[model samples]
Target: MKRFASITLRLLISGVLLVLLFREHDLFADIAPRFHSLLTNWHWTLAGMGFAFLSLFLASVRWHIILRGLVPSLPFPMVLQAELISAFFNISSVGVVGGDTYKIMALSRRLPGQTMPVSVSLVLDHLTGLISVAILFTACMLARSSQWNEIGYDMRMLITGYAMYVGGALVGLVISWFSFTPSLLAWGRRTFPRTMGNPKLTGLIARLTQVHAVFALLWRRTISAMAVSTAMHAAFFVSFYCGLRAVGGAAPVLDVLTSMPIVDAAASLPVSISGLGVRERTFEALLAGLAQVPEAVGVSASLAGWIFSLFWGVVGGILFLRAKHAAHIAPEAQCA
Candidate 1:
């Protein structure tokens, strides 16, 4: 029933956005020509796909670094396989929960008795990824502040609010790091005896504490992981920039860098089906409002990005199927 509700919501949001986007323009008239143009520029499309793949690879490497602190012996190939499978699930399902569940289940099967630590590693990897996005978004906004006057007062206010939100999140993380003491866990256990009395809850709290300790121990590597994450995000923005160029849109690099984070953050909300229509509209609004591009060109560029991402999704689907076959064969091989 819950899953049904989720799917319904996704479809509703996607349908509404699709209508809103195409209500004024002739979809066949506007989009078909742009798509034809995009196909003619195969070189840019291929380049964008290459950058997208590079970004995914970098993200897998970043996850491997985080996993090393928990399971040092875990192979890179295994992590890469899991990451690809996760990506497939993320695209197919409504939200990231599907991908995260796949990661946890796959890792648990591979490493018995280590699920707790494996889960911790996944959480930390996600946290670092968010931090990197916040940092990059903030930096791009600052670097492009001179152009803010062109975007109007409303957008300027939105940018200021986003920067403040990111800054507050960073400060909160630092405070949490300092405040994560063993006594905090002890106090929670004592205060909520009934709640913590559940063996599962107690175990989860214990694992969280262990995660905090491990994070402190690997502070240097954590910083390095953030660097790698930033590079991954850079590749992502570059991929979008290349896609935009492919569609004959000459938006500046800083504009792509600044606008995409907002688009991405909006799309990641569980409001639509993989952010299908929401993403396109966001691209249209941001690119048109900030970069003074035509709404049609903005939508075209967004469609190009969607095409590149869908190509990778197809690859991830193949990888996910291959992993299933491998998993099936492993038991037979072990028995033989």
Candidate 2:
């Protein structure tokens, strides 16, 4: 009942926000024209989807590498299957790993005593994607130069927010590093013996220490995974750029690329289900600010970008159900 209510609330939020966007932007008037544009430029839509899938494939490969650090026997097909399943549920998506709680929990159930290790793997996976976001965002900012002033205050604020988010993540990593270091761990154990006595917390720290070991042991694999993550983000940027073209919008690819990381970050926020209204609103503001893109085109292209995610998510849902029905693989299959 609690879960149901949370879902209901998210649905309400999405509906309210979208309705507001439609009214504010006069999106009602552009609905017919937007559909007409998409129908006519179906090829770009198709290409965008191809890139989205390519991004998915790359994501799977990266996850597979990370898992191999802990679960060496884990198969790539299984990792791919999980990505598809998680994609549909919006627990994870194209470009960003998002909150990988589903994947972590699923893996934890399988690994039993190794829940912490599995969690560490997910952390590493998320870190790879996050580092990529910081890199990509910084690159975009550098590429934008002073013309960035053209995007208006709201857009600049969004960029600033994203920068701060990146900065915070970096700080968090540093703190995590300190906490995990041998000296800090010793200091913590001395300073908080009660916490050290907590089996659960102690075990978690132990698992994190093992993660440190994994990093040392599998540094090459870690690098490979991050490299793949970077390429995956690149694919997502191109795919969204394709969406604008598909919608008959003239937003520059560079500008679209610059804004997309922000769009994805906003969408990844837990506020809206599958980022429905939030994604549209954030992208709409960006396109309007960055390129003077028509509100209709901005919204249309945003939805168009969502289609790639939706398409693969549906495919994943099918695979998920199929695996669920198969008695033999159900236990292992659902872990993905």
Candidate 3:
């Protein structure tokens, strides 16, 4: 019942926002026609599609690099297949940890006793992406430093809020990194002796401490993974720009690049289904403030970018089915 209520509320929120967006714009005239232009702008559409796939592929490569560091015998093709299948889950819930959970389960099955290491690798994989996002957003903001006075106060606050969120996330991650260390664990036990006295808490910390060596397996590769992911996210933002051109909307490369990090972060928030209404609103608002672009174009481009991503999600669905079928076939063949 709790999960049902959460889903219902998300559906309601998304429906309400979409209705409000459309009530202010002519759907048949503006949004629908722009979608049709995707076919007309075939060149841009293809470019967008290519970039979208490149982003997904690069992400897989980063994960493969991290996981390979730990399990040197794990084949790249196996890791790549796992990452490709994850896209299906990623699109399904957007912000939920479906893809990550799937990867953990699948890899844990193969590796047996290495669940902690596998989980750590996935966590580090996402950390690299977040670090890249913070870097890219900062660079873009610096490049636009001269236009600070032109941005509205509300917009400035919004950007500042996002900056704080990124900073807080990094801080939390750093604390978590330290928590896996003996020094922080000892400090925690001393700081809150009573709380740390609980049997469950002690057991949990003991388990975590046992896995401390896994960090050594992954720590050095963090830099290399971040380097790869920077290009990965750059491809993703450029894909958004291609989506804008696909819809015949105009915005400078820098403006689109700057606007998308905010859009991506907002869309990753779990309030709405697949960030349906939220993505469109954030994209439209950022472009309007940063580039003086029209709302209609922003909305259309946001939807276009999502649809391009959804294309890969659909492909992943097929791949997932094929993998499942092959699994079944291998069992039957083994019996024969």
Off by over 4 Å in 3: 94-97, 199-213
Per-residue lDDT of 91-198 in model 2, one digit per residue for the tens? 333223433655666566666776766677776887889988788888888988878667678778878988998899889877776678788888988999998879
Q: Show where candidate 1 strays beyond 4 Å.
A: 95-97, 184-207, 329-336
Error of 1 at 277 (Å): 1.6
Q: Which prediction has the highest lDDT against the true structure?
A: 3
The ten-residue window of minimal lDDT in model 2 covers 91-100
lDDT of each: 0.82, 0.81, 0.86
Candidate 1: the clashing residue pairs are none
Candidate 1, 217-281: lDDT as tens digits: 87777888999999998898788888888887888888889988878877888888878888888
Clashes of 3: 0
- Please report the TM-score between candidate 3 and the true structure: 0.92
Candidate 3: worst 10 consecutive residues by lDDT?
A: 208-217
Please report how far candidate 1 places residue 133 from its true position, in Å: 1.3
> Residue 333 error for model 2, in Å?
18
* Model 1 lDDT on a 0 to 1 scale: 0.82
Q: Pairs clashing in candidate 2? A: none
